[model samples]
Target: MGTYFIVREIQKDQETGEVRDGEIHFTDSNPYAIAYAEESIANRVIDLLREGTSLNNIREMLQNRHIR
Candidate 1:
């Protein structure tokens, strides 16, 4: 089996802006996991874009799907 990082959505309090005590984890092997991973990669691409990284390089890295 391959190692997979678990991603979860957590609710926060509106007034205090504090994370709630518990989190909800979607099922393992869920398509949501893939979407979350892709979103994370996209965010990193945005960061690199802000840093003036070349678009071709960023696209290559995104193609690999290995953030960091």
Candidate 2:
């Protein structure tokens, strides 16, 4: 079995009432357990958000790296 990572974020702009959705997935047959992969991916996503990167950009980057 392979490990999977699902990263999703939803945000709304209060002023413009705009909604933003971001999602990414990474799967690997690595030895690490699924829980570990999930934690790592979650942390990386949070870091990207803290750096002020847009959700769309983050999803793009992740997709470029590895999707599903």
Candidate 3:
């Protein structure tokens, strides 16, 4: 099998009616990699956002970070 990367952009919070955050998911033939990669990338993005990084900037950074 091959590795797969899934990226999801959250548009808004359902209950609070606020804009939601983005998420990244990684999956492979090995299940262990998915768990670690998913949470790690998510938390990292959250930290970056909390540190005052704009969403657009984050998008740009991620786009630059990933070629495919």
Per-residue CA lDDT of model 2 for 8-41, tens digit only, reads 4567889999999654434443332222245566
If scored against the real structure, what TM-score would every candidate get?
A: 0.38, 0.41, 0.40
RMSD of 1: 8.7
For all candidates, the clash counts are 0, 0, 0
Please give the CA lDDT of all the candidate structures.
0.51, 0.55, 0.52
Clashes (candidate 1): 0
Candidate 1 lDDT score relative to the true structure = 0.51
Local accuracy of candidate 1 as per-residue lDDT tens digits, 1-68: 33332334557989999995343333336544322334455456556655667767765775776565
Candidate 2, overall lDDT? 0.55
The alpha-carbon lDDT assigned to residue 38 of candidate 2 equals 52
Of 1 and 2, the candidate ranking higher by TM-score: 2
Candidate scoring better on lDDT of 1 and 2: 2
Clashing pairs in 3: none
Q: Using TM-score, rank the candidates from best to worst.
A: 2, 3, 1
